[model samples]
Target: MAGPLLDIEGLNVDFLTDQGWVTVVRDVSLSVAPGETVGLVGESGSGKTITSLSVMRLVPDPPGRITGGSIRFDGRDLLTLPERAMRQVRGNDIAMVFQESMTSLNPAFTIGDQIAEAVRHHLGLGRRAAVDRAVEVLDLVGIPAPRDRVDHYPHEFSGGMRQRAAIAMALACEPRLLIADEPTTALDVTVQAQVLELLRSLQQRLGMAMLFITHNLGVVADVCDRVSVMYAGQVVEVADVVDLFEAPAHPYTEGLLRSMPQLGVRGEPLATIPGNPPLPWAMPEGCRFHPRCPYATDACRSGAPALTERGGGHFSRCLRLAEIELTGAV
Candidate 1:
């Protein structure tokens, strides 16, 4: 609804390994506008989390590093900011709700303490004001009796309640952008639906940008305004929610859509991509998904295609996107 809030270009992340510095995220680019939600969909080890971490300058330094890229948040280049300045921006201007809320919260602290601590640190609120703000935020996120539950420890809360608390903490600072990495991965169906709806409502109310990372396509369709399909370490396709589901532009996106059980014939096993993603250190020579692509040809096997727009904001990185007749066969 508003102007662009975050813009990332040519993001390259690498990890130092026995094989040398292996590229993890390659030339990755994405953007999120104010009050909009963008989904980054990919399987495990596809560098989705790494790409988000890089935006926050949270990449582990010794073994992992951001080799190149320009992360622009609110038109300011984050990569160029000094550590102290970046620390001030992180949490104050942008927040993240990482996967595995159980592990993300400190077992020793109360939900209120954690959330209030963020407000205290980032917004310079007094102890009482921070605690009051925490209660307000908890209630804002649909937490019942926030005043009573404020003293509950992480272990005392249910899985869904703890996740709500995690979101409450992330929103404590009223950040302009929220990066949620697989926040609903471990929830049950009911809770997952609740969380998704909660996210949509919160975004609408607060007018904050959200970059949601997940491997679930269903979630993307339900909550994302736009979606990007990531494979190996690069984005293969990006399109509006309706456009992507109607007709995915890349072979990998097609395979993923066909693999969903909802689209499969009754009583038949769900379709699946044939192979695991290539190791970042041992990536194939050309298109990363060529080995698994059903319509891969010589061009696909020998030369990777750069991302190109097809029209109406749809983009794909397949050399034969136009040439092949991909029918989404399971």
Candidate 2:
């Protein structure tokens, strides 16, 4: 209905290495609408994190740079924004919650102080007002005794509590877009579920658009409205969550779904995708995923397929979209 809150088109990122400048993210495109959650699912080194980092203009230059494409957020091109303007956009309009809470938080500072800094910077609140704002946000995130907990350092909190603190800091400015990079990866199963539920509730309460980056399809199923599957350096498929789970169109998407460990099959070996993802410096010609694609044909090795529509907003990149009937995760 409404236009995408954040739209990325033809995004290309390169990294300088001993060999040369090799593209790590190529012609990638995706979007997130207001109040919607979109999952970017892929294995390590698939360029998922790179894409998100580029959005915040936090990509480490020299070693990493976004060479092409545009990141349009709420009608403005973020890539072209001046640094001072971008800084305002970073923690205020757009915020990121990294996977590791310990790394994201500062052990030296009190959790309240850390959150208060962002509120003071973005909202331009005075010290007392900022601390009060921090307590309110901590309470919003379901942390107990927010007034007292705010004075505690990072080490004083447990893993899950630290994560909640990280989230509180991100939401302190009430950002329009929240980029969460595997926020639940380090937690146990029960904690993971709690965190996921927390994120869902917060998103609904705040009405913020979320770009959830994770390799876990199960999390995608529970939290994301739409899913984008990335491999090598390209997006191979995009679909609605229910449609993707019921009828995945691409071989790569099918492989990922089939590889998910099913609950009742305890004795059987877990299905796996053969061969590792190719290195960015030495990517294969044509379709980047052809090497690991079970249904790849000669055409697949000759030229990369553009993402083509498979009806009802489901798009897939494959030479055999018609001939193949891929299995679904459900």
Candidate 3:
């Protein structure tokens, strides 16, 4: 197989709060192949967003810092790269469509201007050429009347339209990798479906890899080729989407799957995982999910489990993984 387009190893991120330094992401690692769509799924506050921000080296300063890790893009170590060089790579090589388009877009600038700036900077196109290319991208993302809407401000567009514009900007330069952090969070179901289908079509057309982060399992199954389940700042399991749904290896993965409401099981209560994710500053020792895992044993309390390969490229980080039944009931 070809090398990964993006490779992250031993990645750790920390924030310096009034209470002192606290680790938020711990020894996490993941990769994306060229043109592959990988989903990062977890409940809210499970560190999914932060992980994507870390990849872009966009973690806010004065508090957060990447203490340890190697972020390699196309075999080049990004962490060691100079800030000036990294800046050139950001929007050019790895662009991101943030969760909220309302907050991400610049209210002062026209949507076309914002995208044109990216294209001009990266592709060295003149103002008129960049604007033309921006409109072209907007059309590619299924935004009708691209010529007319290109000059409109972000606030002028509806919620779903704004998201499509944001996505258009991210794809303006045909980036090698795109990190979409909850791209459809605020949209209605119909709009969400449209945006997801657009992304899938664009991915195939552009031949670009994607790191799609979302809490929606249904979305993961629909778009992702592989899924990585995160819990308490660590990846609990990584597997193909079918394997994950059919036979989840980690207890946390099982819990998440079981929690989804089924259509025919009306009288039965929806299954749920017990307890909340531990606070980043106060994460428990050893296995983070052991406290709530039904199959947890004494060993789980004393030592963190290594992410071991189970089979078929599936990996899990649970000592009692062998003991847990997929039925999700102890």
Candidate 4:
């Protein structure tokens, strides 16, 4: 395997509460090679977003803290880096497109100004050159009439356009790694397809690695080279997209695949997992997903299973992985 662009090992993020420190992410580990797109998928509150935030070192400080593990980007361990050095690496070497463009974008600033700010800060371009580059990136992201729309505020653009603009800002510096946290959550199917396609095209053109976070299996199938299924802050499975879709080793992953609406099965009820995901403060002691997992056994309920390789580079954290087959139960 090629050297990873981003490598995470035994990563554990915690939140300090009145009671004590609660671990939200538990021993999660994964890596992304240069130009490779990795998908982190799970239901809401599954710690997918927090994992990405930890990598960017943007976790809320009052309560949140990275208690253990190392996040290495390129060759440096980011956890030990100073705030000043981390800032320099953030937008220049690794950029992120947040889940909600509305919350991330500045309401007071024009779209052009926002994009130009990133360009100027990272590339040190003069104002005029930054604006020009901003327009170029906007055009590249498929924004029509970039020159006119550049002057419009975030509110002036439609939801889809705002998302594209947000993506444009992320790509403005041509960073080596791009972390997109649910980038297509608010868009319609048509617009979502366009945005996903644009991301794929840009990735190929720029040869940049991507950490694509989403709950949509369809989106993962369309863009991700590898898929990591997360549950209650732990990575239950990781595999190439083809291997994962064809023969998912983890019950949680099989459940998610079965839950996706299929074209030929219109009248059938959508499949669902048995229980809700555990809260950060109250995660289960053993396998976090065992309560909802149909194939779970006594061992699954008593002790958490470490992620181990099954076959074809697929790794699963289920104790019954060797006994279970992919029968597709949501």
Candidate 5:
């Protein structure tokens, strides 16, 4: 409720490829207030993962780099911070739950040892204290028989359990800002629901701000306070969860919404966005989504449209948003 815990402006991340330096994230901006949950939604290759990595400063620099923009956390410029300072900030101030839990956890180390190692190294707690903290977090994350299971190896736990253990490790430092990138990927429906609920509960209890990067609109509807829709590395739309769902302003967002399986259209063919997402090396001239936009016009194929405010803090990046909004979701 105070100020933005994380403020990103004009963020540009580029990757050196065979073609040249290709921008994966282009002039992207976002923010997370204290204890607020903001969802970053996009299909794969839309640069969601890289954007999150940029914040954590985990983008492999030789291949990928933050070419432009500022990532400010708690009023400090993370881009300007030294490696040692950034290392201190990574686990302590900003923690990330990578896309998959299985590969992120070490098969050799027991779950307790991994979580305790973070606490021990970051919080400087003693071995005994770190282990206690690990047990406590495991219990907090709803892991059954935490005292015993905490010592189990990653492979020893079930898929859902391993995911829970991963979340427990991320929360071990009790970081102020938690970045979860597709945390529920490949999870069964029941387990996904449970994991999401646990995350919500833990965030509330700890009063932490969360930047949730996911492709699930249903999940976004359930948990996110605000939603940012990304397309071709740029944020196309941003609004409250209800606003974005009920009255999507950007065509890309509408296409995404229309693609969701609706109860009324149970047996019918599901709606899908036309055309493939633009490749980073061969990006379209104007709006990146224009190629797939059913409502695209001459203007859309020319100069790029700027992100414009659309009443009550809602924003959209489209050349003809007014007309498209009147026509409604595709």
Candidate 6:
């Protein structure tokens, strides 16, 4: 089997706040094989978005920075690359569909123009060629009347259509990897499903690896081949979708799965983790999830457990992996 297309190792991101430099993303590592989809799932403050932003070298400076680790894509270390060289990587080799489509699209420019700008900037195509490429991608993403709608402003399009346009822009350059950060967060359930399906279809069609960042486990099960669960700036579990669902190793993973709304369980309250995620600067002494974990022990309060492999690419960051049996999504 071929090696991974995008490999991240020991990634640490820090922010300069009132409390000095606080690590917001700690020792994170994951990879995406060629033509594979990997889901990064976690609650809001789990650093999913920060991890994805670090890959593109898009973490804002002055406030945030990549303090440690390597981001390697296609055998190149992205962290060491010069800014100009990194620019070539962004939008050309890797494109990101951000959380909010409306904010992502420029209101002043037409949809076609925004896409064409990216195509022209990255691929160096002529204006006419870029416009044609924009039309082609819009049509490819299933937007109706592409040639005419291409001239429409962001306000002119509906929410779903705007989201599709953002995707079209991302796909215009035909990047090798796509980073989707909570792409369906703002849409209704139906539109979210449609967008998820569209993303699945596009990945299959383009044969591009994807890093899908979301808190939605149901969506992760539907679209992801592998899953990485993050909590309080660290990855707690990594497994194949089936393995993670059938036998969750980490307590946090189990909690997330159990908390999901299951079908045919009407009126039953959804399960939830006891406490909120800890703040980055004021992180706990030992395991970050210990305070909220149901099965935590005195040992869990003093020492952090390493993310250990349990054979067959399944891993968990729990000291009691062998001692406790956790329920899965199934």
All candidates: CA RMSD (Å):
1.6, 0.8, 1.7, 1.5, 1.4, 0.7
Candidate 6 matches the true fold with a TM-score of 0.99
Give the alpha carbon lDDT tens digit for every residue of 1-330 in model 4. 558989999999988987689888889898999999999998898888989999999999978999899999998999999999999889889999987877789999999999999899989999999999999999999999999989999999988899999999999999999999999987889988999999999999999999999999999999999999998889999999988888899988888998888887887899988779888887777888888888878888998798999977899998888888876422
TM-scores for all predictions: 0.97, 0.98, 0.97, 0.97, 0.97, 0.99
Q: What lDDT does candidate 1 reach at residue 7? A: 91
| lDDT tens digits by residue: candidate 1, 85-128 | 99988888999998898899999989999999989998899999
Of the candidates shown, which would achieve the greatest lDDT relative to the real structure? 6
Please report the TM-score between candidate 2 and the true structure: 0.98
What is the C-alpha local distance difference test score of each model? 0.91, 0.94, 0.90, 0.91, 0.91, 0.95
Worst 10 residues of 6 by lDDT: 268-277
- Cand. 2 Cα-lDDT: 0.94
130-166 in candidate 5: lDDT tens per residue? Answer: 9999999999998889999888999998888888898
Q: Give per-residue CA lDDT, model 6, range 105-166, as digits (tens).
A: 99999999999999999999999999999999999989999999999999999999999999
Please list all clashing residue pairs in model 3, or write none if there are none.
Answer: none
Give the lDDT of residue 56 in candidate 1: 96
Each model's total of backbone clashes: 0, 0, 0, 0, 0, 0
Worst 10 residues of 5 by lDDT: 321-330
Clashes of 2: 0
- Specify the poorest-scoring 10-residue window by lDDT in model 1: 321-330
lDDT of 2 at 324: 89
- Say which prediction, candidate 3 or candidate 6, comes out ahead on TM-score: 6
Model 4, position 195: C-alpha lDDT score: 90
Per-residue accuracy of model 3 over 124-168 as CA lDDT, tens digit each? 999999999999999998888999989999999999999999999
Q: Which stretches of candidate 4 lie over 4 Å from their true place?
A: 328-330
Question: Which pairs of residues clash in candidate 6, taking residues 3 or more apart in a chain or in different chains?
Answer: none
